[model samples]
Target chain A: MQKLGDFKLPQFFNYPPYFTLQPVRETREKQVQLWKELILEYCRTQKIFVIGLEEEFPLFSNPEIERSLSHEAREAFVSALVSDGRAEWLDKGHRKCLILWHRIQDWAEIIINFVKENGLEDSVMTVEEIRSGIESRGTELHGLDRIILMRALKLLEHKGKLAIFKGTTADDEGVKFSI
Target chain B: MKEQLATFRSQLEEFARKHRNDIRKNPAFRSQFHEMCAKVGVDPLASNKGLWAELLGIGDFYYELGVQIVEICLATRPHNGGLINLQELCNLLRQKRKHDREAVSEDDCLRAISKLKVMGSGFEVITAGKKKLVRSVPTELKKDHNEILELAQAQGFVAVDEVERRLSWTLGRAIDALDTLLDEGLAMIDDGHEDGKRRYWFPCVSSISSVGADS
Candidate 1:
């Protein structure tokens, strides 16, 4: 019943061993799987795009249980998600990770559908606008991370579904949708 | 004091030379004495003051043997020839409330036998029913047939089994006396191999004889 910023945490989040990396292979596999699901679910709901292994991540510890995952345990869980292609290491140092709760391909498809439904198939919008503008306000695209929005735009661009161009401030990128 | 010391030394030297001649001549008693010392793990003639003191501490070995002989004699009843093994003899001696009572086991017998071997005197274990029994028949009673014999100028035949019954001592003491007697060459043994018949005799001691007839 634990909720963090409107993201409901699973009942096992209170389990102390859930924070500690289990040593036994079978138990650890289940433990890692549960962590993977919880991480993805939390990121998807909270629109969290990046997780820094060395930095504090609210999902890694539960104050109620006074339990926290060690750095090794955090890396193990993240590495499991990375190996499954559900997440990717954002840097070679593996300190930062980009969670793909919805894959780039899935996000590209959603973008295409959103454009068609909005009747803006050939429309142009700034990258930042797509992330937080009025058109995306009620959708999963609203208030999303710019890096993730860029990755999803790039996926669409590769399929000739859209074109990305740099704008004036480096904060604004132009996305022209062919769909 | 010097003149008195010289006199005492001469007397001691003279006595030593006389006993030395007798000790060298009597090989059997010498060997028995040597064997007993060896059995007790003592060096007999080692002039090392402490060793000699320890050996002398035993106090008159032959006298102790004689007392042992008498004790074993009275300990066994006439009937049973109550078979006392080495362990039992040691226990009885140990329980006498004299000296530090060291319990002797079968290993002590082995060590004693090793000493006997060193002294050129040793014992043979008796055999019963084709089995070499652990029971050792002393040399004195080596010729004893375990037969019921008449005591010296006595009335009735001495029953071997009754000796076992009458002796208040443990059965182990009787066997040890028989062992001592066997060692002293007083008893004869049949080894239980001839004609499946059991017999005992005294070849040297006339005091122990058949009750009625010569046979």
Candidate 2:
């Protein structure tokens, strides 16, 4: 059980083949699936929103085994996640990836629940407050990515459950919840 | 003469039936039985409906083995370039038939491969120095190539200088033959030597014992 900053790694992470991209079709598919699950689980637990390909991501390498995923393998696993709608490439070069462990719809639902629980329905709050506000403390919504927070807010606004308008400050935005 | 022939045929049939299990179990005994049949001007593997085929089913056995040998060769051709070690071929065949009771040996694989030679598709067992390699392609080995392969039998590899000195051939001729062998996958190149001379290794002809001794 290798721990990556309090995130417990699975046993198969030490398997050598898991580092190298398998050439065989069936074996590669299973390896990619395992990597996709591990990456998503790691990101969700650590509240990691984006992964830069060129950066040294801890999940991509194992120092004890001296094994690391090649750039091609990293791209392959990330691409698999993108195809399944669990992740999205933020750039054409695929250098950055935004992982969506919870789909946009699910994120919207979580926002609605947080608003109702905090009695913030029909109340106004800055978009940044939903991410770092005292009401969202200790919840998954706390310290969430501003990009994802805005997307979830837009989804809620489209359904007439909330309204997003420019705030008094240029960089700040406000979200008004009707639920 | 007719009476003697009838008696000999009956005797062979009786011998074959008594040692049917030996033929299947012991490769050396099976080859000796084949030799005896050859000595009598009899072909045991001539047809599946023949006397020996009826008594021991050896003909059909080799036929089935021949099909399997082809499959293994073709399956591994991309990796080894149709030149596979005889022992490796047998190992693969055994693995393929692991659930079956019949055990395949190197001798059995050689026999089955020999049967495949009649098809004229270039299936052959060529000895390089001390290694036995199965060549499934129809590429004709020239005299120069044979000589080089023979020279490689001693040290498991041959350098251009050694080939030139021993065979009294020009550098171009030695390179041409070695290059052909390399292209055919019959030899491997080793450029790791400090002397800056390339050593062409024929895996088929190199004896494992000599390699161990060198190491």
Candidate 3:
């Protein structure tokens, strides 16, 4: 029931060894998997689109035990995520990471459902509207990461579900749903 | 004297035939019967050809129990990194077979372990202090390793300072043993502490189970 800003942390977060990278092969494999699942779940619920390796991520530290992951440990964990395709390093030095908590195809499904529910199946709406408009408010789409949304939209476009075009203003960059 | 011995042997055979069901179904009775058979230099579970074997079918019984033992060992191997206490294993086995009529004794569990044909040098029962540990992995643990594991039985972990102070050993010896255990995946390290003392924890010897939704 430990809380990291309303996100319930797993019990192992309090374990000191969990903060350190395990040297044993089997133990390290299990530890890496737990970190991957925790990172993904945390980002999904907290709506965190990116993780900075050098920045203060709540899950990486436990104040009760005064334990924090070393820089190498943090990089190792995020590297595991990168290998799994659940996350990506945004830079060559591997500083910042883009968290893809949901797969691109899944985000596309959510967008299609939103279109159907809002009666915008054949309508044209700005890309910004899909992210910030009142129509998308109170849904997962609200305040969604621009990069992930754009990727999902591009995936939908390639599948012939939608089309992208320019408008009068950058804010009005339009996505036309032909569904 | 030979006639008296024949009388006693026939009596034992008769007794086994009458309580054959009880001997198989009850752990206490099974252990007592096993002791009696051992005392008389007769092993009903030794082979499947004789009258004692035909009457008790004890060979097959131990064989079936061995399969269940192997099943529990394999399933919980990850929990303790393939090393577990013998008593804990028996408790888990009994819990697993709660619906069955046959209650297993520790002696029966030992017999079951011996009965398993698949167990080669990789599997063995080793003594750690007063307790017996069932090791499913092939890792060869030294006496120093066992001593560390025994010391860790209380708190689930041992700091190097603690190991040094308690065992009256040099710091280098303690570190060498702990490092070997670490390399074997039998011990996990925790360098995070208030005083910055590095610790080595053994899940196999530690009684405190890790509590989490998905451990």
- How far residue B160's Cα lies from its native spot in candidate 1, in Å, is 69
Per-prediction TM-score, chain A only? 0.92, 0.96, 0.94
Instruction: List the candidate numbers ranked by DockQ, top first.
Output: 3, 2, 1
Clashing pairs in 3: none
Candidate 1 CAPRI category: incorrect
User: Model 2 chain A — which ten-residue stretch has the worst lDDT?
Assistant: A22-31
lDDT for predicted candidate 1 compared with the true structure: 0.56
Per-model TM-score versus the true fold = 0.44, 0.52, 0.78
lDDT of 3 by residue, B35-109 (tens): 887877777777757787788888877877787777766765554677878887787777777888777888888
Candidate 3's displacement at residue B184, Å, is: 1.1
Is candidate 1 or 2 superior in DockQ? 2
Model 2 segments beyond 4 Å from truth? A1-179, B153-156, B192-194, B203-215
Output the number of the lDDT-best candidate.
3
- When candidate 1 is compared with the true two-chain complex, its DockQ is 0.00
Deviation (Å) of B180 in candidate 2: 1.4
